[model samples]
Every structure is written in structure tokens, then in C-alpha cells.
Target: MNFSEVNIGLFRLVNDLGKEHEQLNIIFTFLAEYMVFLLAISVICIWFTRNKESRIMIFCATITFTCAFILGKVSGVFHSNYQPFVELSDVNKLIVKEKDNSFPSDHTILFFSYCFSFWLFKRGWWIFWILLALLVGISRIWVGVHYPFDVIAGMILSFAVAINVYIIVPRLNGTKKILNVYEKYEGKLFQPFRKTKGSKTRNY
Candidate 1:
């Protein structure tokens, strides 16, 4: 009937699954907690590829994440809720989280911000990234660290920010200039490792 009721119902549906299918708790816990490090590693690998397009995509994702993070903080200030485990009885809580404003799940905002930007930039593997973001959001609820509405709010906010960043960031001349300057220094640093023009192959 009310939004709070609906939110709690959805949270129960997902959180209870961990109780019924205890095996899945491991996977959901990983998604909820450790997947962030995977995302970070992926970003670093992409940036080190020395590919211009990939670098630009990473740049856009970073900007989207930063903006969404700021917005999420502001949203938290206005609307806040404790973790579901703290508020509800018999919650299938799988992860430890500090009691604080759990509204607009920070993990959800973080994953959706970067994942959506990756989806927008690299359409070829769009489903993978989007699905990953979705799973992370759901996992937060499944682990009893967030309510459904908290994850949903984060997804909505990050989706909007991702779209705007994708539309606006790449088109700016300043973006190109910054990339160019960084690449210039990068090339200088890696110059010794580069093969010279018309160099003879050295016998191993």
C-alpha cells in the first residue's frame, strides 16, 4: 500500500532467498562486496591498453562515477534509512556494514555509474556490463544491507548521470586536449620500449 511497505516486501523477497538457498549467499556476498575491486582492476587494464578509445571510455566512466557519487551523498543527506538487517527482524544478512543512511545504496550507485558508462561506450558487450550492475544492486538487498528502494534510487540516479556524461564528455574539446597531453607524456615514458623504425630483429 505505502512505498515503505512495498520496499520492505521486495527486500524480504530477495533477502529471504539467501535463507532458502544458502549456497547462493556466497555468490551474492561476493557480488555485494568484492565485485568493486574487479571493476577497478578492469578499468586499470583498459587504461593500460594504450588504446585511445578505451582510455576515453574509462575517462567518461570516471567522470560519471564522480558525479553520481556526489549526488548520492546529497540524496543521503535528505533521505536516509538504516540497513535492512538493523531495522527488520530475522534478516538474512550476509555482509557486515556500519549502521548509517543506507538509502541510495552507495555500492549500487558506484557499479551502475561505471557499468552504465561502459555499456554506453562499448555497445558490443553492453549486456555484460548492464547485467553486472543489476546483479550488484540486487545483491545489496539479498545480503540485507540495503532495501529495494535504496538500490532502485541509486540505479535511477546513476543511469541519468551516465547518459548525460556519455552525451557531453566526449564532445568537449578540453577532453581531447587533456588526453593529448597525457598521451604525450606517456609516449615519452615508454619510448625506450618502442621498436625503432627499420630496426633489425635481434637474435635471442
Candidate 2:
């Protein structure tokens, strides 16, 4: 009927979903927040390890996620459309206004960027990162801060950033550094994966 009525109806629908799938919602939120922590540690780890490929990868992930956060904040400021996920207590609702801008959720960006970065560091971890990111993306919509379209947009942006990093890292001056280190250890580095292992072990 009226706008307020529509809003109330939507809120009730979302709240029902929260009640129905609270466990999934909690899991996604935890995964998203944990990425923030993991990404920070990854930065320190890369800086210490300072391998050629890792340096480039860490630089890309940090820069991309930073840009993503800035973009989300900017969009939140410029766009108009604020919706609340939960029914805040009357006092809290009175004190703070809801945020606007559903496009390109910062949460999604944070998850995907971290996922991509972790994937680069250890390819085996990619599956875990991807699944976690997927759950986080869905949670944004499930909890009602982002529209499904908004989450999709964030995913696209994250994918673009990751792909660009993949393509451009090689062109950087850093690629030489990575290659040089490998070159110096060519016999060991270039050997096939199977042979390189067990070389230190006895035949028996």
C-alpha cells in the first residue's frame, strides 16, 4: 500500500529468513570477518617472505581491497537508499541513520580479495576461499544490506581486480625479480615436482 508499509513487509520477510537460517548467516558473517584478519596477516607474511611472485600478489590484493573499500564508502555517500537489516532498539534507531548504496558491497569485496590473495599463496586453499566467499556474498543479500544484483556487481569488480593483477603482474619490473631468484636455483626449481621430492631420502 504505502511506502512505509512496503518497507515493513520487506523487513519482516528478511527477518523471517534470518530466523530460518540463522546458523548459515552466522557462519557467513564469521567467514567474512575472518578474511579481514587473514588478509592482514597475509600482508605481514608476504613482506617477510618477500618472494618475487608473492610481493606482487600482496601488493595487488592490498591495493585492490583498499580501492574497494574506498569505492563502497563513496557509493554509500553519493547514492540514496538506506535499509536496515535488523530492528534496532528505539534508542539506537533514534541515534543512528541507516546507510545507503547497495552496489558493490564492501563486505563482498573484502571476502573476494582475501580469497584471491590466499589462492595465490597456496593454490590448494582456493576451494576453501571460494566457498567462503560465496557464502559471504549470499549472506549480504540474505541479511538484507545488499541486493542480489549488488552482490553480483561486487563479485564482478573483485574478479576484474584479480584478473588484472594476474595479467599485469608479469609485466611489472618485479617479474624479473621473481624470475631471477628462480633462475639462480634453476636445477632445483626447474626439476619436475616428483623428482625434486624424495631426493633427500634413501632408495631403500
Candidate 3:
């Protein structure tokens, strides 16, 4: 069989599980839909920490995601497919999605771009981010919104961008300068709330 046949068969394997086990459908549905908001909140919280390392990590992640997103769009121009539910029979579609190009799943691109950047920057306890990315990719397939090839293509594209961003961004003098300028303004903005020695209450 050709690649498209294999892609559909793999999608069927994952999507069919939702029909057999109702409980997993709920989990995968959440991962497919709402987990992105959680990831966004986490990134914002990390940025507010004002720690240089965390800020740099966030910068690298942002750049990685931007580049990957552009690449995904470009790839869509060349190759595009509707969602699996739109193309195949007996799809276990769990979420509401409009009919559009589903090649190189956008969710997969987004999660892997940021999560893999997190893994590269903080290797210890942050490894869960990689697992989270993988689950999100699978969840897209399990929800019947994407084919296996869509998710796989996204993973490969984001991983390549993430690795390059991690290597190049940190070494750039402009990255450091931008961080320093932002931190300078940030410190002033929050200065009134900072506690002073021998003062029980903050100035603000």
C-alpha cells in the first residue's frame, strides 16, 4: 500500500480507541482542546518570574514557534488535506472543527515547538514537556481531527526549528541586550511594590 493508505490505517488505530473506551475520549478531548490554554498560562507565568534564564527560555520558545508556524503554513500551500473525519468513514471525531487544511497539524506544531524548547533549556524536571507534546500530537489523532502523517510532519518540522533556535538565539548579543532593556523597565514598573529594609508594608 501507498503512504496515504498507511496514514489512514494508523489514524484508525488511534481514533477507534475512543469508541471502545469512553473514559479515554474525555482525556484525549481535553488534551486536544483545552490543554493549549494551560500551556499558554504556564508560559506567561514563567515570563513574569523575571529570572534571566527563564526569560531566555521563553524567548527561544517564542522564536521557535514563530518559525515553525510559518513553515507549517508554507507546507500547507504545497500539500493540504481535510480532517480525517471529513475524508474517512466511522471517524470518532470528538471536537468541533471547521473543514480546512489538516496537513501538518497546527496543534502538534505549537506544542512541540514550545515543549521541546523547554526540554532543551531545562533538561531536569522539565522533560515532562516533551511527553506532553507527544500526548498532544496523539490526542489530535485520537480525536480524529488529524491523520498520522499530519502529526508526524508537524513534529519533525517543529523539532528542527526548536533545535536551531536553542543553539543560535542564546549566543546572539541582541538577545542579551533586549532582555537587559526589558528587565530595566520591568524593575522600575514594579519598584513601588518592592519591600524596603525595616518596612513591613510595601511602598505601594
lDDT of each: 0.89, 0.61, 0.91
TM-score of 2: 0.59
If ranked by TM-score, best first, what sequence of candidates would result?
3, 1, 2
Tens digits of per-residue lDDT for model 1 on 52-93? 888888899899889998999998899888999899999998
lDDT, candidate 3, 1-204, per-residue tens = 999899988999999999999888999999999999988998999898768899999999999999999999999999999999999988999999999999889999999998988888873347888888899999999998999999999999999999999999999999999999988998888776674532655443
Q: How much is 108 displaced in model 2, in angstroms?
A: 1.0
Q: Specify the poorest-scoring 10-residue window by lDDT in model 2.
A: 88-97
Q: Candidate 2 on 71-179: residue-level lDDT in tens?
A: 6666656653544434322111111225655556777887787677657555335677788788777666555565555566677777777766666765778667765
- Using TM-score as the yardstick, the better of models 1 and 2 is 1
Distance from true position, residue 82, model 3, in Å? 0.5
For every model shown, the clashing-pair count is 0, 0, 0
What is the alpha-carbon lDDT of model 3 when measured against the actual structure? Answer: 0.91
The regions of model 2 sitting more than 4 angstroms off are 1-16, 23-25, 32-35, 67-80, 84-98, 117-124, 174-204
Candidate closer to the true structure by TM-score (higher is better), 1 or 3: 3
